[model samples]
Target: MRLALAQINPLVGDLAGNGERILAACRQAASRGADLVLTPELSLWGYPPRDLLLQPTRLTRQQEVLEAMVQELARTMPELALLVGIAEPKGGGQLPNLFNAVALVEAAGWRVVARKLLLPTYDVFDEQRYFLPGDAAAVLELERRGQRWRLGLTICEDLWVEEELQGHRLAGPDPVAALLPSRVDLLLNLSASPFGQAKVPLRHALARRAARRLNCPVVYVNQVGGNDELVFDGASFVVEACGELACQLACCTEDLKTWSPGRHPAPGPPADAVLPEPLEQLFRALVLGVRDYAGKCGFQRALLGLSGGIDSALVAVIATAALGAEQVRALLMPSPWSSSGATDDALALAGRLGLITHTLPITGLMAGFDTALTPALGQPPSGLTAENLQSRIRGTLLMAVANQQGRLLLSTGNKSELAVGYCTLYGDMNGGLAVIGDVYKTSVFTLAAWLDSPAALPCRRSLGLPERGELIGAAIRHKPPSAELRPDQRDTDSLPDYGELDPLLRALVEERRSQRELVAEGTDPELAERVSTLLRRAEFKRRQAPPVLKVSGHAFDSGWRMPIAAG
Candidate 1:
């Protein structure tokens, strides 16, 4: 039987939009003469419906939409068998829990034949808060093209059999392992997996091992698009029974794939060109994430303050790539101490990329703040207080534009700066979303190098635009990185060089190492102590920081929450 895996992107509460997307995929598959189609988990109401599931009426509305989708499928494509996911309500002292269920659609109607047996509750997942465990195995018996196929259905956490071998299986029985005894010919798993820096490799290995062990072809469909701060990279695939890859879907997109049981019965390297660098992959994902977030949040344009520095420059590149030049706007908000070269760079980059640029000097805004504070202090301040005032002025101007024009304000701050509490809280930190908040300073430099090189950069998905040579001009790369909040300032003045600081931060923040442990790993005792102190004191600041995409195993979210006095 010809099977189609629809790697789709769905909105959280757009029930009609989600159903329409599923139907469109089924129609496309049927046109290609495929007998069956599969979509991502929770395609009906979108994954992680969160509190939307709390509304009793919302679930009823979802049910109505599902019934309508079934009727449409029965009338329009009777020969195609479509498997889609939704929240199934259980009865009899079930505490009104929802199930990650798969509904089989055919000419007769729809039946939720399989339910997920596992619920994950680690890191970012809080499934235990909403869903109850399903005790029954998910096995579906269907006939397609006069062939009887017993296909096992698994949700995102259902096919997590690797845990059993590793002794980490805590949620439920291994869903894939349970299928081996059923003598199934094929297995299908649906997922809404979140994106992480090193998650793709682990995903491939998981699917390959499962397919090899079951000795049956497995189709994996993953959800794509940005939901809040979580970006889902949909690099879905079809693996053959013997672990050969038959087909692969596009990354960071909504893609469709068709595969047959016996044809090319093994998964292979992804058909699409591999992302050349971690930065390129990350860039593409970030651009897509921002684009989808703004679009889905009902905003058409985004505005950010351009400080003529690398962080804002990189953010502009991502914004232009994601939302296009016309949809993004940048303002050069310079203070008296702001360098001429910074403004030159900002205008030159904007001109080269064809983005709308504006200038808003903070001289008047600074005067206003100083006047308001002069009453109690009797004089304008100097040093860190004055520097922060400039930042706050720029931030206030950006927010004004965002409020007036209905644009989403994008904050331009990197993880390195955020880690050390180098940024001004209400000043530069005022924005709706943090773009490169997950990226380190060294990684930013690497990304700049790749964007300038002719070769494809690592971690970037396609920008869907013509290449403009190197993204970051050579001068920007060669210049020393600085926030420019103070006069004649360089980053190294307040902190260690990026080369020294990034590794230590990675070890301490991402690896969760103690000061002693970091020092034992060859980190200087002085630097280690300083880094630990900064990380601790910054807890209050991080708590108020905007939502950032989690691209690493350890992101600065609840996933990596540290007590204020942990040190």
Candidate 2:
């Protein structure tokens, strides 16, 4: 049997659009002589539809969309069958009325084919909150070329039977192990797994492990495109019985590829030309993330304060690459204490990127704030309050520009600052989206160096950025990171050096390390305690901060859930 794996990008709640996407894929598959087409998990409603799932008209709309798709497929490609991921309403009277489901639609009509067993609640998955798990495994009898074939079907989390993923245990029924009794010839897993650093290897390992366990070839199809903070990298692939990769699709984009039961894939590492280097992958993910977020949120222009710091510089480059340089506007909100080099560096980076820069000096605004607050406070605002005042002024000005120009304001704070209470609330944390808020400060420097490296020039030029030496330049890279709120202000004064700080942050935030674990790993006990304390204290601020673009194993928003007032 020939299978068409459809990796499509869909808008959440766009039922008609999503159905059309599936029908179109099926038509194309039929044109290419494929017997059946498989789409990503929740392809019809789009994955993680969030509160959209709770709408009263959801089931009605779903029925209407499915009927439309079946009719369209019957009219357009009568012979082709489509396996589409959909939300099946299991009826009301329970807290959850849905099952994460897939339906098989052909010329006759559509019926729920397979229901997901495991409802993952960890990290970005909140499936258990909205879905009731299926009690039994599914094995379908598919026919092609007048021959019978047995196929096992599973959803995203059902395939994640890994005992340990980065030491995080996902306790669930082993879908592959259960499928052994079903005696399926081929296994199909539909996923909407988002991108993370070194995540591909883990995903590949899981697929290989599953195929090895089942002793049958596995077909995996994942959703592609940026949906809010999550960027689904659809590098869907097929692994043969012996766990050798037979077929693979493209990553970070909409792709469709075909495979047959017995035919070996084109060999040679499943097209390395499209699978980018890790640095390049991160860059591309951020670019796609920004582009999709802006467009989806109905913004044509993106604006950010260019502080001449590394965070702002990196974000500017990404924004320029995502939206054209013509659409990305920069504001250099220099304060009284802002160094001349900082101003110069911001201008130089903006010039290199060909972005329109507006030099909005905040000196007058700073003095105005001081005068207005002096009477209320009985004295001039100084120290932390003074520093925050500067940030708030810049934030206000940036908001003004964003509002006037109708540009989405991009927040430039990195994960390190956000980890601790180093950022000013309603200040530097202001924006529509926090681009690198999930990226560690150490990783920020590493990415900057990678961007300047010769390997990045090709991807850079292709993205329409400067193809020459040092797109970020040396000054921005070498400069000590500062908020420039006061004289000679350095981030190190408040927080540890990024080299020392980032590891602890990752271990604590991403790895979920303990005080004992940190000490065992040779981390200073006091430093560990201090950093952990800061992380907890900053929860309220993070709750109020803009949504962060998740690139690491764990990010602040949906994944990192903590009670604000709890001990």
Candidate 3:
């Protein structure tokens, strides 16, 4: 039997729209003569539908759409089978009253074929809040061409059972191990897994382990696109029983492919199976995140404050690539403290990227704010207050322009600044979407350097970026990082050097390590304590920041739920 993996992008809460998307993919799969079609987890309402699952009306609408899909399939392709993810209602007076489930739709009708056993509650996933676990493993037997095939069905977290591979395991039955007794011909996992650094390899390793254990080829399909803060990288693939890759789909984009279990291996890599370099993968993920976030939110254009620093430059490059240079607008808000060379660099970078830029000097705005607030403050704002005024002025201007143009405002702050309270609350942090808030300051430098290097030409061309030399320019990439809020200002003046700070922040934020642990590992005691204090103190500021496009395993988005009143 031939199986078609539909790596699709679904809009959350749009039940009718998502149903149409599924039908469209089914048509494409039917044209390729697929015996069965598999979509990503929660393909109906999209993954992490969150509070949308709580609405009774949407649940009713889901049932209507499923029935409509059944009728449409019966009228069109009467012989093909389709597996679609959905939230199945279980009316037994349970709190959640639903199961994260898959429905097998055929010409006759549809039925709940498999329910998810594992409900992940960690990080961005809150499945336990809305779904109850299925009690048993699901096995579907189908006859095609007078031959019966047994397939084991699993949802996103069901296949994530290996503790050694996943670092930690959820408290649930082993879905892969349970399938061993069924002697199934194939194993299928539908996932809505988000993109993280090097997560693609981890997913492949997990699927390979499942394939080896089940002694059957495993097919994995993932959701692609940015849903709020989460960006799903749909690098779907088929793994042979011997832990070898059979076929792979594209990353960070919608894709569909059909594969037969016993097809002979082709020479070299499988078609579309080669993964891009790590840096390229990251860049592509960011571009997709920005594009989908803006597009899904009804914004055709994006606007950002274009400082001459690395963070804004990197955001500019990503925004240009995501929405095309014409759709991305940059406003250069130069203050009295802003250097001429920095302005020059910003203009040059904009020219190279073919971005539309308007220089909005905030020197007058700063003076007006100083005069207006002098009475309330007893004197003109000075020192940190003065510095923040410049940022707030620029932020207000960016927001006004974005509001006037109906554009999505992209925030340009980095992870290091956000972690250390180096960012102002409503000033530099103003945006609808934080493009690189999860990226460390050092990673920002690396991304900028890569964008300028000759190695990025092919990917740049693919992303609609200029193929010419030095898109970011050496002057911008090599310059010392600064906010330009004060005279000769440098990020290092207020925070530790990024080279030393990023590793510590990674340990503390991502690994959940403590100050004592860092000191035990030979870190300076004072630095460790200071960094910890700053991180905790910045909780209030991060609480109000925009939805950050999550690239790392840990981000300051929905997953990081720290209290403002925490000690």
Worst window of 10 by summed lDDT in candidate 1: 457-466
RMSD of 2: 1.5
User: How much does candidate 3 score in TM-score?
Assistant: 0.99
Task: Give lDDT tens digits, candidate 3, residues 438-554.
Answer: 999889888888888888988998988888788888888889888888888888898889999999999999999999999999999999999999999999999999999999989
List where candidate 1 sits over 4 angstroms from the true fold.
Answer: 92-96, 163-171, 265-277, 457-466, 563-567
Ranking by lDDT: 3, 2, 1
Q: What is candidate 1's local distance difference test score?
A: 0.81
State every prediction's TM-score relative to the real structure.
Answer: 0.94, 0.97, 0.99
Tens digit of per-residue lDDT, candidate 2, span 157-191? 88887776645556768777889987888999999
Q: How close is candidate 2 to the true structure, as a TM-score?
A: 0.97
| Candidate 3: segments with Cα more than 4 A from true spot | none
The numbered model that scores best in lDDT is 3
User: What is candidate 2's local distance difference test score?
Assistant: 0.88
Better of 2 and 3 by TM-score: 3
Residues 432-460, candidate 1: write the lDDT tens digits.
89998889988888887777776653333
Alpha-carbon local distance difference test for all models? 0.81, 0.88, 0.92
